[model samples]
Target: MQKKVNWGILGLGQIAHKFVADLKLIPNATLHAVASTSGERAQNFAAQYDAVHYYGSYEEMMKCPDIDVVYIASRHPRHHENTLLCLKHKIPVLCEKPFAMNGVEVEEMIAASKSNQTFLMEALWTRFLPTTKKVLELIDDDVIGEITGVKADFGFKAKFDESGRLYNQNEGGGALLDIGIYPIFLALLLLGKPEEIKAIASIGKTNVDETCHMLFKYSNNRIANLHASILNETATEAFIYGTKGVIRINSRFHESTSVTLLLNDKEPKDIFFEFLGFGYRYEAEAVMEYLSKDVIEHPLMPHSFSVDLMELLDRVRKEAGIFYPTYDRV
Candidate 1:
């Protein structure tokens, strides 16, 4: 392999655009290929991202020898198939999060990766952000004392369109599988898998979750309160409280640039991190680092992490009466 890592992108959506921009930020990484169902869209994305190859057929791109790794940003329902395609070609994959429609799909993807001996990791961008790193650092130092609870909420008002992925059950539309995963991941990163989970959700006219709320109980007596919705606007922030102090994330905490520390009664101190492009570069860098080391998975967000996370999503959705297929919608 050359010093430069060649990347191929599937699905020319908004997230793919952001990821391509970050690909340019990494000196040793280059966007070499792109594919979309629409040839025009694929060509346009390739032109904009300086990709050398563009195809309307994902299979064609998978056969391209210039591509070393592929990023799958397709609709949630297609993640399993898209990942399998790359793994079949012995190409590594960095699949965008909500790894698949459910735990079943996630397990299959993991099996494919292991069976093919190819690299695979879910692209949960926030896990590699500067703010998250600092949060983990603070917690490790015990600056926040014994952790007791975590609270997070993410929501927005989206125009109702049942045909769109955001409201289509077949496309894996629902607050819990979409934005809800953010808060759940944050809680898991801090507290591990919960001992007990209670979740409630409001199913919209489209049979998708307009809103979802979850409470998790840990063996250590810690609990996490999380919420996600598309029916209304929310505070969209996160707070972690401990016996000694609290760590507060700014609004839109998942992608926020700053993390504030408020210990006991002391004045709040904010630490800021300025990032290039869309902050997806951090994850891209991590992937490159892992590849350079000949590793099949990233420790920060490994295959097990993706599996565990998907199981949590599965449990929450089942308890809330959500299903993956449109036909299964109640």
Candidate 2:
């Protein structure tokens, strides 16, 4: 018989609900507990998800002996402390992306995980998607030949809510840290770090970037054009161009399940991915699998990848002259 991996959710938010719905999709994965600031919300979520336990405070959930791992779904500013608290309690952590505002905080989180000998992984769901893996394989097989350029964008015309998370600098809100990371992740995953990064942003009234456009130049002469914005709407598509042909990832590429390949004078080939519950199941499955094997970090989306990605974000923010006021608060 296999031992079940019981999961404890530290914040009951939008993402937490999706993760809980997917928990039942994994074998031997149980929604053991959920925590929220409101006791009513925590109890309701527990009942809705069939969790065996629920707590009004994160500290209370951390002390639950039934939970094998803790998933931190708190806001960007709270990830570091939430993770550290879990680590000290000997619980592994799977933290949501924009990992912790910046790389310095990420380093400290990594250190805590190491010191406690508990597992910790940045919960970047894109890297674990079936579509993402297929896209990578196609590139590796030179399906499009020598890569020359890449273009991707993620944006939406978000309503003006200065106090809300998206536009509020005090809450670590900005286009670059929120949506720009998706495009940057694609570039780095496909082309590695670039020699030159040219970026500019439109700083909105709240002082956070409303839009950001980035250009990366590699030593191999390859270039990537990436854009992100919360002030305007975009197609949210990603395209890869090469010497032989091109490959296009359909709308909302970051969370998309379809990819199309085009070869010279040939009809386009489309590949589709089918997965469980909001497509977050794949990453959750990866975490459970690692825990069952007594492993610390996921090989596919390792700590180094998280660190490097944050380093890139840090550099991009610097170039764009965008800084969040939440850094000091975190």
lDDT of 1 at 164: 82
TM-score per candidate, in order? 0.97, 0.96
lDDT assessment of candidate 2: 0.89
| Candidate 2 lDDT tens digits, 159-249 | 9997788888977788988899999999988888989999999999989999999999997899999999999899999999988899898
Clashing pairs in 2: none
lDDT of 2 at 305: 89
**Candidate 2 regions with alpha-carbon error over 4 angstroms:** 328-330
lDDT of 2 at 204: 92
The lowest-lDDT stretch of 10 consecutive residues in candidate 1 is 321-330
Best by TM-score: 1
- Candidate with top lDDT is 1
- TM value for model 2: 0.96
